[model samples]
Target: MRTIGADSPQGIPSSLNTVDIFMSHEGLLLEYEQSLTRHLPSPTDPKGERKWYNTGAHFLWIGDRTRQPDGAHVEYMRGIENPIGVKVGPTTKPEDLPELLNRIDPKKEIGKITLITRYGAGNVEKYLPAHIEAVKESGHVVVWVCDPMHGNAKVAPSGVRTRHFADIITELSKTLRIHKDNGRKLNGVHFELTGDRVTECIGGSMELSDEDLSTNYQTYCDPRLNYEQSLDVAFLIAKYYANEREDMERNVFRL
Candidate 1:
């Protein structure tokens, strides 16, 4: 695996000998999450007040389908101290963002919330800028993450659910560019990928086609990038960010 944040020309801090890999999952099942919830001593509070945290995963996110303002998911998520993520899709109203932010993060703590954008390749150009603006205007501290997988899924000719690599790349590239142009840093990315040789997603350096999918199609739900394709995406993101760093160095005023 290519190590990031250490021994690179980009000057990432060498604070640790090993890279930390965090596990994040969609907080879809409320009952399971509730079952794993634990009361832990508050890290920030000096008064010794305990905080509720879902210990099943290091990070948890509310799905787009369950993020209603006054809904149970939102209510449950607001009570937890674990860093929370909320899915923001094409249908997410820009005006509703502040209210949602206020509901989840009333204190507006930095890094307390993350907004994961999954607008498909076609809808990103139409929707993202406004969401960015809305979040900025609200003055709520939030990390922006791009999830390019879920929205680009399509059924192939063989009737197997799959996502096109080209579409995924397009969405990711566009999200990066859009965030840079809008004067915001896209803090991270989310992808459905695996370290196996499953041909769930088509079109990469291997030129896997729709017919090739049936050879090793293996996902019970949405498709994922195979080992080779996952590397392709990793390299693509690294290259884009490297170029961005160069651009920032060349023009300090580029934002």
Candidate 2:
């Protein structure tokens, strides 16, 4: 749950690193602040400036890996409330993407790579592992966005509602632990959070409620938070691992 800070480089603290270094490409957010791109990159990279992910200590990754370029799509990924990568999936044939991947090669020439998979990008498990494993299965890292909010109202053929947000969370948490026990440092979590408090989404009440979860299909605006709400969750995540670091010593991860 790493936050895009106000003072840190690109508004992120140098010391804190999430499993995936997200690069949001939300040019439509300019509707709220016209000057954001003066500091951030546009969908077109209007300024053609270099990206900070190029040298960030953590692995470089992107999110919202969809092919849609509409305002709603971009806002979902690039909005301040949703500041993750906004690159489309392959087949759109965007030249800039491949170049970015090359620049952020996690292998560091060690023959291993850090590969990313988007939650809604589809068939993530197969395509992702195959890609990175092809590079170097021995040490490859695979990090997913694992949003706290997903699914919708309609029940799937599996007889379970799509709004089972906790299911994925629990699944990913177990995945992390397995990675930890197996001593895989390449696996990590990527969360999209802001500084705002959200009363809707997963849970209702002042906290969250089951009835509040998205139904049928999830719209782009299903989940959100206020500034204080976002910060509390972010700090909590940071502290949880910080405490684990104390108890587990070197085995616990903080980045």
Best by TM-score: 1
Q: Candidate 1: which stretches are off by over 4 Å?
A: 1-21, 252-255
* Cα lDDT of model 2 by residue, 135-248, tens digit: 333332323333333322334443434333344344344434433555444344444444444333342224444543333223354344434445555565577578867878
TM-score of each: 0.89, 0.39
In order, the Cα lDDT scores of the candidates are: 0.91, 0.38
Q: What's each prediction's clash count?
A: 0, 16
Worst 10 residues of 2 by lDDT: 52-61
What TM-score does candidate 1 reach? Answer: 0.89
Error of 1 at 115 (Å): 0.6
Error of 2 at 218 (Å): 13
Q: What is candidate 1's lDDT per residue for 148-189, written digit by digit as tens?
A: 998999989989999999999999999998998999899999
